[model samples]
Target chain A: MNQDKMGKGEQSRARLLQAAAVQFAAVGYHRTRVSDIVRQAGLTQAAFYLYFPSKESLYQELMDGFFQKLWELSDAGGKVTPLARHEVRDRMKENLLELFRFFARMPEQTRIVLTGAEEREELHRKLTSIVSANLRKNQEAGHVRPELSVEVAAESMLAVVQRLTVRFLLSGERTAEQLAEDAAALLAKGILQADRTKEE
Target chain B: MNQDKMGKGEQSRARLLQAAAVQFAAVGYHRTRVSDIVRQAGLTQAAFYLYFPSKESLYQELMDGFFQKLWELSDAGGKVTPLARHEVRDRMKENLLELFRFFARMPEQTRIVLTGAEEREELHRKLTSIVSANLRKNQEAGHVRPELSVEVAAESMLAVVQRLTVRFLLSGERTAEQLAEDAAALLAKGILQADRTKEE
Candidate 1:
């Protein structure tokens, strides 16, 4: 949303949301009040209510937007036609890099949503469904192991992504590309050395 | 820990702690009151105080115990001498199964600790350190791949275990052995099909 191009009402609403994100990220959702948000946004209480019915609704909208953005990213990456095992691995790496970049771009919101228990659960559920569907497709294409449970695989992958994103990327300890490379390699071939690959 | 061996004072303390776990797990730590916990245990506030100073201390003790148990499990599993890749995989599976059984046996405490944001963060930190150290030793023993980051690998593995434990084992949708099998397979070989092994 371009501040200069937005209408007056839209501009006010955007300001309010931006302020709320900062406030929520700093003190959390429960401690943040409407008055504080409005004051930070340089808007009146009436103006805040004009854009959002209640503080709860505004917070919900913020979460909804964040989740929606992540869903779109997951869906977009899954749209690639079924590929070979190596190609799938590459695609996973690319997708993970993109995700890490998104987290870096929105560190505060990412931390807020990922650290909150309920919000994290909701995000995980959505990511699992999308990732599970993609894995099923890959399994059908014979890229993934047939015996693997897509549910477990998806959840596990998301868990790894979440952990790495928070500890490595968000904390500035490692680059997204570096984390993505290691994560993709780990998920593709795992931690075992070369010898075990022959047993299968 | 055995109720049959406990004296009167020990029994009272155990009841209070049990009551607190139920209350905290049911309604969360912030909403639960000391009065409610004592009442549920059929004890008075003074009795509760005799064992613990305040609600915060009691909650902290429960969290500490839960984390300590998990740390010990991870540490014990890491004690096996370096072995063949297959043997290591077997050990991983067995360790995961044992961890799952522990979660199943203490479902309430598991849920309480896993669901709480602060508790979950602290537990993740402890588990990651223990697992990371184990991975480092395995790497030194020529088991894990040389290129892999033990930090990433350990955190990823713990994330998968946590996800599977909460989603499948705690929900009773899968047995401990079943989840351990899938988890170990995923962590050992990942989801990729067999052909990619040659690329490495």
Candidate 2:
């Protein structure tokens, strides 16, 4: 993983991706050109072409990289086995913290994805499916309520995650740890207090 | 509200709005032309200009209308008073049902907003603030958990509402009543069953 160990081509490709993410986030996708990317990367147009066919393709690659990392994290929660109350909240906080940290690590890519990814309905649906599957697994393991709609739950969870990422994490109003703790607690027990509104 | 009761100018404006929604949702904003909208409305280009200065303006109006209705519904949730458990869920259901019904009643605007509204960060924040204010009111009223972050909860609630509207309601996969019912129960009690994962 050492930079010195990278092959010339690999290094050039890495430079291109980093440059593209920065330029795209700064100037936006439409304004950021292939020339801007290459100049920023200190490479020629020919070198850029070797790595990507077009500016759009390079942008897509950056987006795919962000989502790919996220997809990997989606599975990092592992099996949601029944756990002590505190342990359950801790596990949720850990998973959410990882997501916020990913955003922190790749701010540029996250910015690009936030602006452009909504149009890609397929991406939204796929992520929802992955989260839904995880919830389904939890349900079967008795960690989640059996009668709950997993699809709805997954979609709702993603909604909350996306909102918090954009509002709190991105804005620096809260740390990844603080945001995760608050979100995990709210999500675990929900907003309701015990038997306060329990049916008559 | 009767179309036959409308005056000539009012009729022309309504026709233009309807035509623009259909065209915008069909071919997207970029590909859709003023001429196409005018033709669909069976009106002259002159009449279209009299109603809207440009295609973009017309599209904005439609989007505004949708969000305006949603903002009204945001207020309609009203003060959260201590109520029977079933009444709490029913109130949530009624509020959510109003939202789904709004989407159902304005499918074209919903489609356009779904595709484009994410770019409007102000709109998202405003809606979240409104929802958060409602949650804050609930917390003050002793219905919601006082420790819960109302801001995060509001953002999460809006997220879930948006997702369900787009996925299940828009696609006709679920009815408004069903969606509202499921969402209410989930929001009220959350997904974790009582004492299942309680601390040792």
Chain A TM-score compared with the true chain A, each model in order: 0.79, 0.76
TM-score of each: 0.80, 0.79
User: Model 2 over residues B1-200: C-alpha lDDT tens digits?
Assistant: 78999999999999999888898877677788899988999999999888888877887788876777878998764544555333555577788888888888998877766655433467677887888887777667656667778887787777787888888898899988888876776676542123233331
lDDT of 1 by residue, B88-110 (tens): 66676788888888888888798
Q: For residues A20-73, what per-residue lDDT tens digits would candidate 2 score against the true structure?
A: 889877767888888898999999999999988888788777787777888888
Candidate 1 error regions (>4 Å) = A1-16, A41-65, A190-200, B1-14, B43-67, B190-200
Give the Cα-based TM-score of candidate 2 against the true structure: 0.79
Each model's total of backbone clashes: 0, 0
Ten contiguous residues with the weakest lDDT in model 2 chain B? B191-200
Task: Please give the lDDT score for candidate 1.
Answer: 0.79
* Share of the reference A-B contacts seen in candidate 1: 0.85
Which lDDT value does model 1 have at B197?
A: 39
Which fraction of the native contacts appears in each prediction?
0.85, 0.75
